[model samples]
Target: MEAMMEQREGVALFTICRPEKRNAVNFVVMEALEGALSEAEADERVKIFAITGAGDEAFCSGGDLHEFGPLRGAEAKQMLTRMGEVLYRLLTFPKPTAALVNGAAMGGGCELATACDFRFVKEGSRIGFIQG
Candidate 1:
């Protein structure tokens, strides 16, 4: 599986479980995130959400370009639009969201973190607003 969900400390944690690719977000991963977000939001047990990566290397690398290879301009744009919609829903979720960046967060991953109400990163990790 590419993701996992857990609850603790009055918060629900959604982890990007792919550490080999630095926890990159593919379409499937995005869907999993959407589901996790929806499930937690609907469950009254969840008051806050903390998104993070599974390993020490990265919070997320970005979109999985390898998953959508060689798409033309229009195709890429449409796909990106879909991803945007997912993020928009997450951003507008009623409860507070946090990105517990244990490591690097880049591109769409960084946007995911920024969309949250709080961003708590480890001391040595880097955060970037890159897109690729």
Candidate 2:
């Protein structure tokens, strides 16, 4: 699964499951995030929404360039636009949202964290926006 969602203790946890790619966001991951938000929003038991990445090496390194690097023109725009919509929803989510930055979070990963109401970065973790 590109991403996974679990509900526990009134929190809806969303995990980006792509450690080999540093938890980069691809089309599938984006869809997973959107779906997770929809699911959690409708669940009254879910009091908070939390997002994190798989493994300990990185929280998220941003876009999966290997998957999306080939795009141009309309294709690129559509992908970016979708991501923008997802992030905007996250930012405006009615319930409290948190970003569990378990490791390095770069580029779009950094943006993702910032979209939340709170960010809990792990000790010794790094956060940067180095992407162009």
Candidate 3:
């Protein structure tokens, strides 16, 4: 699985677990993340949220270029719009939200981190929008 969900001290931690792919962000991953966020928000036990990548290589490396070719312009637009909405939900999550950036955070990965209210980055890690 590219994503994993766990709870600790009322904090719902959603970890992207695709190290071989450098934690590349994909539509499916985004949807899974959104689902986890919604689930946490609705759960009475959850009071915080966190996001991180599995390995040390990357937090997320934007969208999967391999999957983008078949996506039409309209589909791409819709995907981006939906991603924005999901990010908005995360950004405005009622409780404290934090991003654990331990590695490269490119494009949507950086966007995802930026959406959170707080970010804790490891030393020597890259955190920014990369490759558009």
Top model number, TM-score: 2
The candidate 1 region of ten consecutive residues with least summed lDDT is: 63-72
Model 1, C-alpha of 33: deviation from truth (Å): 0.4
Query: For each candidate, what TM-score against the reference?
Result: 0.92, 0.97, 0.93
Model 2: C-alpha RMSD to truth?
A: 1.0
Model 3 lDDT tens row, 1-132: 989899988989999988888888777788899899889989999988999999888888777777655788899888779888988998888988999998998888898889999999999888776443
Misplaced by over 4 Å in model 1 are 130-132
Instruction: Assess the local accuracy of residue 7 in candidate 1 as a C-alpha lDDT between 0 and 100.
Output: 94
TM-score of 2: 0.97
The CA lDDT of each predicted structure is 0.89, 0.95, 0.87
Which of the predicted structures, 1 or 3, would earn the higher TM-score when compared with the native?
3
Candidate 2, 8-127: lDDT as tens digits:
999999999999999999999999999999999999999999999999989999999987899999999998898899999999999999999999999899989999999999999899
Ranking of all candidate structures by their TM-score, best first: 2, 3, 1
Count of backbone collisions in candidate 2: 0
Sort the candidates on lDDT, descending order. 2, 1, 3
Show model 3 residue runs off by greater than 4 Å: none
For residues 1-132, write the lDDT of model 1, one tens digit per residue: 999999997799999999999999988899999999889989898999889998999999889889866667999888789889988988898999999998989888888889899999899998987645
- Looking at model 2, the pairs that clash are none
